[model samples]
Target: MTATAEAHATRRRTYGAARLLLTLTALAALFATATPAAHAAEPVAQAAYLAARLRADPVYVTDQLPREIPHSTAPAFARLAKRTGVPTYVLVLPGPSGTGKGLLGAVHDRLGRDGLYVLIDASGVSDATAYGVHAPAADAATVALYELPYDAGPLRSFERFVDVVAQGSEKAAQRAASARERYGDEDPAALYLGPSDRDNQSFLTGVLLTAVPALILLLVPYVRRWRRRLPGAKPGRPGAKPGKPGSAKLDSGRKPESGKPESGKPGPGIRHRLGRGLVPAAALAGAAAIALTASLVFDQTRSSAAPPPTAADLTARVHRVTEGLKRDSVYVDPESARVLSAAQLSRLHDRIRAFARSDGGGPVYVLLVPQLTEDESAGQYDVFTATVHRKLGKDGLYVVADPLGGYIEVLNYGLRLDSVGLDLGLPESIGSGDDQAHEADDHALGDRLDALMTYLDKVPRSDEPNTAADYPATPEPVDSHVLRPLFSGDFRPGLLMGALTALFALALTAGVLGIVGKVLRRRNPAPLPTSTLPFTAPTDPSPSYLRRTAHTELSALAEDFRGSAGSGDSGDSGESGDSGESGESGESTHEQPPSGPSGLLPQVRAWDCFDAAMLLVDGDIDALDSPGPGPETLVAVVVLSRAGRAALRGEVNDLCCGVNPLHGPAVSRHHVRVSAEGRRRRLLPVCESCRNTAIVEPATVHTLLMTLPAPAGADGRVPYIETDGPLTAVPNGIPRLIDKVRETAGVQ
Candidate 1:
């Protein structure tokens, strides 16, 4: 054979191989797009396929987005994975914002290990999932990434995550809660969507809404009047009173000899009247319908619901969305469930993808929503699933997982969901035999799906889609209190509440204004219309300043006595040099009494009462800033001085005021009350000034509050007159105590 012949043969073989490849590709494409109507060309969902590689290695990184997340992150991920205590697997891949949980779940299913699975997307969005692991791996991961700086690297976030999980569940949960509050409960928009904000917005919208109908109704009459005013129109109703304004104007121009003008063309006939009535009626009906629709739409999407569906609502809602489910594989009723988290839904997407393949069974459709209640339509589980299956007409597993219900159910129709492996609904299928090891994550939707997917691998397929289904028993209802929703499909409850709030506020404000206006009208009322101004004439000034001369005089005298005691002598000479005592006690009785303490200084050195009073006056300033040289000290000083001088003059002493010893001398008796004591008034010696004060401003009257009575505990410091304690019985007791002390000193 020649060289050209050989080359031609090689070309022919290459062309044949190319033709076969093209033919196979064309056939595959045709079958994929045409054979299964359910597999309509929709958006292709991305999935995480790291289980095989991760089984061999604890850490895996996809270099698909090499520029975004380099392969070098593997070592860092590995280091952090080892620190999680429970066995840990780490994967770094290009996952968009919300796909973290789903990605990890898919990987976890294939790996089939009880460990903490950490998945980090290239953008540093991540989550940690745990299957039968004794660790707070999930919350730790949630909190750690949330706590780190917004632009932190994936490895760095993972490092913080390891630290959080190591701290244990309590701390991890607390931190997770804190992280939840870092931004807010929901989004920042929720800040503006709070109860108060909702009320305000609802009020404004409600007012605007209410006004629109009113305005339309108001315009109906005007619009009809304007249409009547148009040229060649009936000026007034037929067979109307000719005396009416528009009716008479037409009759005045054309009245005949009888002057009736044919009653304005016999009014309108029955058909015309009926037709006229129908227009307005139709308009009113249309207006009412518009308002109703607007109200319903608002009601449907009001209160940005914070709450998930209730038990009954959940079951009924599943029924409501069955028709929707027929059209689309995924029908997340915006009403019945709390918005499923991005990660969890993405995970459900992964399982759906796995089940959807014929290699397993036909394509699977996983319905993810919060089951409002565990006790569903009794006896309806079998019927409901069958009814849904018949409607769908698909040979695949229908897995329904409610995060709130805490259980996953499978309604297999031709999809061998339970035939090939352990049934997810059966507790014993967990293989641990210990029921507690079964994923008891009843409240966590992600957790329930995670457990379900563990037993759900590639389900074996069958041609004549037969049913092999399992229904989980009704779970005990989970307890949750839903607050005012941030955004909900139901608006009436919040609207009614807001309307009530507006009404209450309006009523309160109006009531207050009315009361205040009435009171103000009686007091500073609007004056009668007068020519002159409603002003007062200028008045002369009369202001007085109280000197409190007694306070200063007593304070000065006490200071002088203190100075003399220290400087003059700490001796009895001040008392021994009395002028009349040695001369003649009888002669001394005839002399006039000295009034102030300075005059009695010669005897003060021997008077124990005077000495004690001086000691009290010199005591330290206290915490309460109470005016010291209290009544007890002041009374003792004045009484002792007066008593000493009286003994010199053979006269009776008049002590200072009993209520307030700061007032000079008590020349009269007055009635008063003491602090915290019974309100009963008492007669006591008081100066003219104190008497006036007790009469006019009784509360300002001071008392000799030296000590508390027995009724008051030792710690209680009720210092009121009449209360018993260590101090003398005020001004009256002072003189008696002084005289007793004088006799004890043998000076009498």
Candidate 2:
């Protein structure tokens, strides 16, 4: 109940303050217009009273002043200061009378407690007819100055600072509600409701801190969604435009593009066909999505707002140093910005002055340029004046700039460098998972360089501005976050934002690629082969009975044809064009036959012969096992007679051997053995071609077939005779043929 009551009271107080501020503003305006110079005195007197009261406060005493005041004015000063407790200085008009001294004494007594010390005893006032007792326009004026750390930036233009406070309060309430939804009725402390103590300083500071992140978050999605809907959305979407300017220009008097079919047309040149393969596109999309999600989840915008150094600012005591040299000024939540206090402000100012005054003050000015929105161009986001330009007079201001494009050029250059990966000693960092983090950092650095260039460019056009240091250099210990890199150090918000942007790009690219890839893969494709090749019979075919008869007949037929052809001419052949024994030659007396068996001879059952030969060679003759030599023990040899060799002399060759009858073996001697050792030899069939000449190998001959007399006067077929022999130097006939067969079978 106490907390709630306190909150309520705070709200009421803010409201009252806002109302009072508004009234004061109205009265001031009225006085300016209606009563003129005479009317300004009341406000001046009121200001003086307020300043006196603020100066006497206990909070301002030891901590602010550290000085003593005259005893005569002590009581009055104390009474006034006790009422306000605000620290402020009252500017009094120089006077020779004791009244002026008394007022100064009273001011000294009250404001002395704080640093709100008065500058009085100025009888040497330069302007004789100033805004004083003489009531004349002059360069100087007596005024009351008060230190109120209430921020009245772009967030709140009116004097109603309370309105800004209210906005923050409302946001806090909403956020609290959101927290409730997510974490249930848990303690608010876990939510990090406000900084340390929920005082005005905490509240204001918290709100300021939260604004930027909130704006970035709220704005980015809005941009993307709006961009997506641009081709489809109605001109006026029937909702309030909010803070957008000239938005109505788009809706009025403009013919919206005709709506296209719901078939969602993508950007120009994007093909409807899905050409990208699934695996690659899907993988890319997944990666992109992950990156995007991470970026969004961890976005922090603070990294984008690091303050730049200025030679003039370093020497100026009128400066305010940022708690962190953070570029971001916006807050993620309003409540976070509401916590700024006068003490904090003063400290910031002192630090800034010290920093600016460290080196000799040159023509330099400090600036608190706020970040621009996404929609605003850099030009539109330019700073209009130096420090507090709109409120305080422009002379001797911080953040001073001439009326030229020099500063803007510098800023743009910095942006460019930051984008292109140049480092300019600025505190910028790449966001985690950000594709363009490096680029952004580069651009920021470029912006600085560009700024320097612009400054150089404008140097000739303007005279050097006055420079002075307002404070001494005093190094102060900063928080780890402040001293660390912009990304993860003190301000992670900026880094997070950068990451999110990169991720969004990745996700978008992936989505697009995925959509296209799926479609493309659906089109042209090379599918896996349907089924495997039909199985072939095994090579070992010597397991059956009926095969022997067929094999013998085929073998006999081959012998008969070869013999008839005279071992040279392609005989009894139908017509396979001109034939010649085109193959390797046998060594010594006999000539080697053509590589292939005679397949075209009519008398020879050619196919049957080949089948039998293959069976014998593959040792599959067992598959045809009937009786006798079983085709396994049988060894066949080609014997070239002298006559048969003559036939091979001409191009019309009938024999497998490349020999002429004239070149045949010397005698009609024939004996062959299967092995060199003469272990196996049998009475095998022999053709007349062999008998015509004595064709015998000396090493192993089991038996010789008698040579047949010249085939019955030339027109007769060569006789076939049986011979006994085992296979000897099995001719180099079929190795190539077997290799082809193996390849077709997919063997190694």
Candidate 3:
């Protein structure tokens, strides 16, 4: 099988096992609550009855006596009997009952008392009374001596009656009786005659019991919603200014700012948090107050009252049975004869006999008690079981029934001893037989007995020796019952409320922390600085110097050309002198130019140097050396000028292949050269194929050169250049000169 099928099967098995365990647990609780018949009073009565039987005492005192008779009182009784020459019988019963008189007569008949037989009914403080049997005939005075005193309490009156009888004081008894009569009747409402103390609850107590849990359930959701909204007061939209016609208004009729609260007033978030915090506090306080009030009212209203006469009778019967009192018949129903007809009783007896004769045979007895509550019937059943176990040597099945309560209990004793399978396996095989029998419509005592017999008949008769392994293993306890409420399929208002309350509480806590953090941060602002930039000098000054040198060379070249043109060549010797003078002046200018008036030489020289740098870096030195003016040449100049020579150098340096000035690579080490001729300078490439071409100035190159930075420094000092003669060599001389110019210009 696939994993999913196996998992599903495992889950199904787990659920089935869990369901079976819950059913068993519920059944166990039902049994425990319904059958509380194993009362402590039974054992005490058993010990007392055993003591009485062994001593052969005619005066039988049940264990239900309110207090033990003083040792002096017993001696007084003995002395009175000795002096009067008459035997007395005393019977102390728990409460008044119809059989009290009969019991007293039976004891008197058996003991043959001559003086008197006394029966004390101790049902309640106000109802206690004494009766004397077979006493001497007396006038009102003598009869009064046997009566209780009106002024005295129940215990005191009993003592007074005993004292008067012991002293034989008729006059004193008459006075006491007259005084009791003068005290009048006791209040009936002060007495307690119910089966349980639970009957004393007042109406107010009932109302509070229902109200507290309901209130808690209702408040939980309200609190949770309030807390959930406590984080921030969210506006309808962003950048929605306050006092606008369309904005939402605050409680004060003024529009609230987005993300801000009103001055000197808590925001909606704060108010919500405070309200949420108080909800649980109020609910808990209310619950505690109600609980305290109920407790106080219960304590003040409680009374010390005794159980009813019927409960006392039931208890006495149970004790009697516990003391080995067995009836001659199979059914014992004393309340009414119509409960079970003669034929039904006969049929029940036959069924019991048949069960004894069958496999795993054991005698069965049925005890039908008067109607009692389920709890009361269970107690009686326990006592009956003990009594039957004692008489039948712990080897019989006893069925006790309370027809009025419509309940029945089966007590199995020695079934396991006779046959393990019958004891261990029979109960499960019966399958809710006792419950079904009790719930039957007829609810007849005889019918319940028949049902029990039918259940017993189904018991397996296997006599084969069985080991512990033969039985199915006990199942592990499951927590499925704890989770049973969650799967009940009913709406749980309390659980929902509790969940909402928790969610809101968490939100409130987070919001409060956030607000506190903002306040703390505002109180301690960060420090500011005195200056924005750090003071530092340039690392390299070569480019600055080269720029100045290029300006000086261009200025002197321009100045010499202008001076030669304005003055005209005086002679060939004069022209040679001027040329020689200009060469000397150019060489001197290369070392350092003289400070003079502003001229265009510096600007033109800076532009020429910039153009040359761009061509070399762009790997387009051949175009600069071309004699013809073409579109390619024109495009390069326009691109360089628009982009600027520094920007052009950066762009070409990114695309070039060999090392060159302005940080680019070329196909040759000295791929491009600058040519200076009298008043003009041009760039040329040293390619072997382009050695014969005459260099032409492209308009784009000239325009591009105009955008280069002028060779001027902040200090106005011309850059010093080192050169031996005019720059005439096309390759080695021109490049060295340009390098010197760039170094002096500081064009990094």
Candidate 4:
């Protein structure tokens, strides 16, 4: 009981004189504290007094100094506390207070009360504590700050907390509850445009970033058109006269001195051409991007609020089950999301013991839990079960079932274990003892496990060795038919952050490309579409340019080997496309003696190829002084430079990719349908990456072969590789190809 309660008790039990004396003493103490001398009291004494003050009024204010929440506001709060029906106490302290838990606990201890106590500092609800009751309102105090607008004061949060703490505050509680839900999840991005996946957001951002520079370029001409129409826009220009006000207007109506529109302002014909040439691809990309965004947005809004658990969480959960499996044959996750009835659990336990006693090849261990997210396992339910078996190192038929989906995954690990080649309508995993798993809401998961055990008891394992045809072929993965995770929930923070960073990079790249494209267009005329050949790309690198690059590299390598003063290296080569061979070759690994041209020069290895490459790299352009270099000879230098640079590098293995030399060395040779000598099938060396792609892709991989000039055949580009090509010399070493290029180019 409080001091006030004790005083009331005394008034009822004690004599009139004693009661009167008690009241007078209390009054004297109250008046004494009200005096100016009370200001000198220390903070500890003030805290003591603050606790005492709570007995009289549920709200206690520390000082009489100026406060945003003045001392007068305490009485109104006191009334609010009185209306709560439960005992509520509020303590208001001065500033510089760290955490409120201590003060709240100290005051509650001093008061010796079991009630809702809230400590309010100058900052706001410093802390809230429930002495002897469950109070969610304690968490609400901090949540209110986030719920309120950033500019909202602490008083507003304090009010919301009190409003939710008391009974019969339905109106306040409803508002508070909604705000609490939205507290941490408020979308902070300016481009939020409501709820949507990060991919969609990135797509829109990329499109905008890409289009911005082009849009700016397009606007420049219109801006110039407007400026030219303006009177005296540019002083002393030929069109706009200084003296005449109508000079600009007169010039606008006049025919052009050269018949073309002004530099910035293109005519209708030019605009149409630009729209046809430039706008279609951009518009198509924008439409595709927008469609992708809309699809994700539609999917996200309909999904759940919880994020799918990560692989680590699932693995941890499996480890938790490993302990349970050791103790019992039937291990069910008690805290599983898919709740099991007592009867269902009892039945499942009996079934497990029965299966263990059966004549099956291995004893059965069963586990039941909720369904996992499809993101990890599309349809393969054996991952967790396999993990459990690996951890336990047991030999038997182990079963893990999703109590939510009634899906059973059976894993056989022991050497004595028999394979169950059963298949229901489902078609991804090896076995399907999970009868009604494909059909939603068919049977309880525990009941499903019981049914599977009963089926296994009827079909016991055999001791005889099984042949290859004993089990059917493994079914193809039907991931599309499986239930994938809902996109509506918040993904893991790491994934979200990674996706955002990637999208930002993509947007940056798109912006750079846009700027580069605009600059290129401004510098050169947009080439008209071609009729006989492919679309016009005026900046495409010619074979001559590649020849110069090859010479530059070969010359540098020659100088580097000859010079011991410095370790000068050539610039990195890249894979780019155009004219003869579409893409440039990847850089060769050429160190001085071990890997570079110097490495091959020691034993006089590939000397003929190297000599021929050197001859073409210099002799064709310098000695003959003919029209630069032949496409065949130029491409030959490219081929020889790679082999000559590094004799033992992986890139030089198997004579590189026969189809595309730029693909680097063929990791393995693939049998091809292409015809060779005497109508026999041919084998072509291909890079591992390209080889893997060839298996799934129906179409053929692009060849790096360049056709010869029209003189060989009318508009028939006879590929340099096809004409006096190295096809015959491919399987054999590069020496024959070197001699062949020398014979063809006639470079001696």
lDDT, each prediction: 0.46, 0.28, 0.36, 0.47
Model 2 residue 569 CA deviation (Å) reads 30
Number of the top candidate by TM-score?
Answer: 4
Better structure of 1 and 2 per lDDT: 1
**Winner on TM-score (2 vs 4):** 4
Per-residue lDDT of candidate 1, residues 1-748 (tens digit): 6999999999999999999999999999976656233222111122223566777788876532233344545675788788878898877654432252355665576678888877776445367678878888778877765666543556666788888889999989999898878855443222113345544544545444434444444444444554333221222232111121111101001100111223334322443476467656765675567556645644423222212334443344345557677766665533122324455567777766665553545556666443321123322344445545654666666666543333456666665444434344444432222344244422444545555555566344444545554544343222222223323323445445545554565556557656755674443223221112111200110111011221222232332333222222221112212221312221211122234463233433223333333233332112112343333333344344434323322334445556644333466777777565567776777766667778898865544422322242354444434443223455564555555433322344
How much is 252 displaced in model 1, in angstroms?
56
Regions more than 4 Å wrong, model 3: 1-55, 63-86, 94-103, 122-157, 164-169, 172-180, 183-185, 188-351, 358-362, 367-396, 401-748
Query: Where in model 4 is the C-alpha error above 4 Å?
Result: 1-196, 222-315, 337-360, 374-380, 415-420, 423-443, 458-748
Candidate 2 CA-lDDT value: 0.28
Clashing pairs in 4: 706-719, 707-718, 707-719, 708-718, 708-719
The number of residue pairs in model 2 that clash at the backbone is: 119
lDDT score for residue 702 of model 3: 22
TM-score of structure candidate 3: 0.26
Ordered list by TM-score, greatest first? 4, 3, 1, 2
Tell me model 1's lDDT, rounded to 2 decimals: 0.46
lDDT by residue for model 3 over 1-748, one digit each (tens)? Answer: 6999999999999999999999999999976754233322223332333234323753443433212221123333344334322355444443322132244434443444444544433331222122343223222222333243332223333344444455454555565566556544532233222212322233334344334544554546543443322222112211111121101111111111122444676654665577556656776776578657756654422222221223343345445444432543365433212245556667887888788887776677666553322122323445445544554554566566654455566655555323444345545313234655546433545555676678678766545422222221221121111222111222244345445554565567558756764564343211111121011111122443323322222222222222222222221111221211112122311122223321223323323333333322221222233333222222223222222222212222111111111111222332222223233543433222122222343222222111122143434222111112112122242334344433433332
What local lDDT score does residue 205 receive in model 3, on the 0 to 100 scale? 40
